[model samples]
Target: MPFFVYGTLRPGEHNHDLFLRARTRSEEPGRMRGLVLYEGPGYPYAVEEPGGAVSGDIVTALPETYRELLAALDELEEYAPGDPRNLYERVARDAVRADGATVVRAWVYVAAPAVAARLRAEGRPIEDGDWRGPGDSRTHRRG
Candidate 1:
């Protein structure tokens, strides 16, 4: 199945290794509309808005590998699949690439409502660029 990954799970960030380890293949850029990207304390989260567009890459994994990828991601996000406090939930959503083509049947990590409320209360505005947090230069060392 195709999964939309933003944040560290994108190509060369920290969590990208995990996805690569799972043998997942990534598509070109795609976006989720109506969600504003907010910087959480440790990572990034998205909040639903009237007109927001969260962009990221779409990755496809084999059905047999989906569970493993999900498990790894859940752990990385400090979230359990069925837990209430979890910030992200797996959902079937459409992703629009830069070319304006939309891909359906993709799973995405959408920010939970509760998490969004907390972020808003903390007065964190949605960042305009890649949400890599403060002190993180965009450079990554190749292994």
Candidate 2:
């Protein structure tokens, strides 16, 4: 199965190597539509939004490793299955290659609307809907 990662899980970010690198069989740049991104404390959160798009990568994992991969990412994202207070919710969405050549169903972590709104009110909303990573200063406070 393929999973779309838009934040820290992207390659070279702190969580990628530990969570998705070896676990995934392959990776390619991708983008997801109708989602807005907000700058979280240490990561960015994605939420549904019309006319929005998020840039990221699609990571393909072996079927046997899919469960483990999802588990690790869920833990890293503070998302426990069926938990009411999950910081992020894991959901399947359509992912398109960066070139817009193809689209595939891929799991994605999205913050609930209320949570995202709260975060945006307190911090900042990634207006461009792209999240590089925490270590990249280029992603924040542009002014």
Candidate 3:
């Protein structure tokens, strides 16, 4: 499955270099609906919401790197099956391609229920949904 990454895991971000560089088959602009981006330390968290959307990339990992990448990302996001302290939950969601027509189901790290509640109550959301910002000029290399 592909992954929808909106924050530090997106191309040009620091974590992307450490974890995704040279490990993906493709990385392209995509948008995930029904989620909101919230600030979290130096990264960001995607909290589920009814009328929101988050800008990101739909990343397909190379067959050889898929398993390792999935484990690495789950660790990075602090997601563990049924873990009460988990900050995020890995979920299958639909992500729309840049053209806005094609859609693919991808793994998305959304804020855990507890985290989402807290964020909904008081966290700061990235109003534009793009973690890199509206004037972002970071170029992404497609695999």
Tens digit of per-residue lDDT, candidate 2, span 33-130:
98888777777788877888988889999777889888888888888878878888889889998789899999999996568668657857777677
lDDT of 1 by residue, 1-143 (tens): 67777677777677778555556755566787767787755557767775777767888776777788777766766676788988787777777776887555677777777877776687465555345434554542121
The TM-score ranking, best first, is: 3, 2, 1
Model 3: CA > 4 A from native? 138-143
| Residue 14 shift from truth in candidate 1, angstroms | 0.7
Q: Estimate candidate 3's RMSD in Å.
A: 4.2
Distance from true location, Cα of 3 in model 2, Å = 0.8
True-structure lDDT of candidate 3: 0.91
In model 1, what lDDT does residue 113 have?
A: 70
Residue 30 local lDDT, model 2: 88
Q: RMSD to the native, candidate 2?
A: 3.0
Candidate 3 lDDT over residue span 27-95, tens digit each:
999999999988887788899998999999999999999999999999999899899999999999999
CA lDDT for candidate 1: 0.68
Model 2's TM-score against the true structure: 0.86
* Pairs of residues at least 3 apart in sequence or in different chains that clash in candidate 1: 34-52
User: lDDT for each of the candidates?
Assistant: 0.68, 0.81, 0.91
TM-score of each: 0.78, 0.86, 0.94
What is the number of residue pairs that collide in model 3? 0
